[model samples]
Target: MQDDLVRRAVEDGDQDAIRAFLADICSLTDMGFAAVARVTEDRWIACQVLDKIEFGLTPGGELAVATTICNEIREHGHAVVFDDASAEPDWRTHPIPILYGFKSYASFPIFLSNGDFYGTLCAIDPARRRIATPQVIATLRAYAAQIATLLEVRSPPTA
Candidate 1:
């Protein structure tokens, strides 16, 4: 069913299908700006964008959003959508979103079946987008599960 579709998407590197899947699910629940990122031990990788996305080197020449999301996922496992930067106490001072034109965001940690975290599946928007429905969160979680599976299959085998 959904797993087969997602597996085909992964095999084809069909980012748009992944994005469309998120968008369709979100549209049903009125969420916006869905995206996915990969995390390594030391950094998060921005692998796919669903909408209104932007990223580049910071003034310090490091991967933007990687550090912040990695830390949060490590600490909390997932981040619920926030309407605005003002609504987020800790992220209010973080430059990643502000510098990159993101005003609202949500992200879920991508974890393998064996419990290794690989990155995140997220949504972002330039304006405050309200996400009050549990269904929307559930949709995001489903996408995150697909992302984790993709990472597991794609990652190099360990010795």
Candidate 2:
């Protein structure tokens, strides 16, 4: 099925590297959860995850596309980041942070080398975190780029 292909695209690559990227991002950002999810027009599928806080999702798990901020990232093609969602006037009304109970969050778009929007490298935590700094953003962007590259390498060539 299409879902299986997406999952294999990530798992078929250097899975150890993907795992390391998620682990490093979680540690570097001091977040409890990190994942690379495939966000398409109608679905949000978890390709990989590092869940220290037991958010309870694993590879192949699906989240409703409309409920995730990553869906917005897919639409706007930009990163969404915040240190304290409750403190942000915009996020105060945004339901995702409140619904997920995550005060700190970040999601960066991963564009494949062919310019296709792949998905995202994202992290979240229940506590406030200093993850909005330039350094942290840069690191995350780097990781997203790396993941994109990895996926592209394993993907079939476009006709």
Candidate 3:
């Protein structure tokens, strides 16, 4: 059933359908912007961006943040959320949002079945939004899992 949904999403080039399907199973969480990025040596490539709403940044800015988050996730190997970038000491001076017009973000690393860190699945908002519930986190994690599965299936097998 899930595979069918995923296949349909891929076939239709429907990023929102993919994200919404995952969110429905997990419960809609975090204002509904999700993306999938592909990690390469020393950098990440933004592959897909899914959103139920629109924001001010251009596609380029979105791609840039996706790449940045992918790199960060590769280094950290976990889920992260910047609820209030302005309040976060570590990120207060980070020119990402100010430069790109994005303010809030949540992301998780997508790992291949072999445990290789491939990239990340993320949600971003131009407003300072908080994902403060365990359910929300769980939902994001589940969506990340689905993304990982998709990546694994799409990637050529390494022999």
Candidate 4:
């Protein structure tokens, strides 16, 4: 139920908009998969996904929170980006990429207006791609903020 709410919030009652936004993100970053995932301490639920490479996850699909790098983004509220995980010293041996078979990865934190961590806007590609450019990072940040604003506006008021 909680995950459903978060997914709805991320969708903001507009499936077309969310889909288009994610498609744009994939195009912008040259990634085959892009998703907005609702991450909690124990779970990672996909809210929206654009899967060009048939990576096999759809909206509402769940992944073990422990297996995702987004969990770390949730911990520190920072964006993680790598042009080629297999070539980057820090991520070359990291298990997530190896486990997922993705060469390029990027994830940006999404926070609500009240400063609560919501989840992440992340993308991945099986082939190494240049995704860590300043322009791409800035665009991802802007998209994240846009998502946050939509969620904030659509969220139900607190009791």
What are the lDDT scores of the predictions, listed in order? Answer: 0.58, 0.87, 0.60, 0.85
Best candidate, lDDT: 2
The residue ranges of model 2 lying beyond 4 angstroms of the native Cα positions read 1-14, 157-159
TM-score of 1: 0.66
In candidate 3, position 26 carries an lDDT of 25
lDDT of 1 at 56: 41
lDDT string, candidate 2, 1-159, tens digits: 555756674464437889999989988989999999988999888888899989988887888989999999999999999999999998977999888889999999999876888888899999999999999999999999998887777774364
Give one clash count per candidate, in the order shown: 1, 0, 0, 0
Give the better candidate number (1 or 2) by TM-score: 2
Q: Residue 46's C-alpha lDDT in candidate 4?
A: 86
Query: Per-residue lDDT of 47-101 in model 1, one digit per residue for the tens?
Result: 5554434344211122444446555675677655666775688667777667656
Give lDDT tens digits, candidate 3, residues 1-159. 334433432333235545454455323554546666655454444455555556432221324433365666677798887776778887777766566456677778877777887667777666777664687778778877776676556553354
Model 2 has an lDDT value of: 0.87
Clashing pairs in 4: none
Report the poorest 10 consecutive residues by lDDT, candidate 3: 56-65
Better of 3 and 4 by lDDT: 4
Ranking by lDDT: 2, 4, 3, 1
Tens-digit lDDT track of model 4 for 1-159: 555655574465346766777999888878999988878888888878899999998877788999999999999999999999989999999999999999999999998877888889899999998989999999999998888776667663243
Where does candidate 3 stray beyond 4 Å?
1-27, 30-32, 51-67, 156-159
- Model 4 scores a C-alpha lDDT of 0.85
Model 2 residue 156 CA deviation (Å) reads 3.7
lDDT for model 1 comes to 0.58
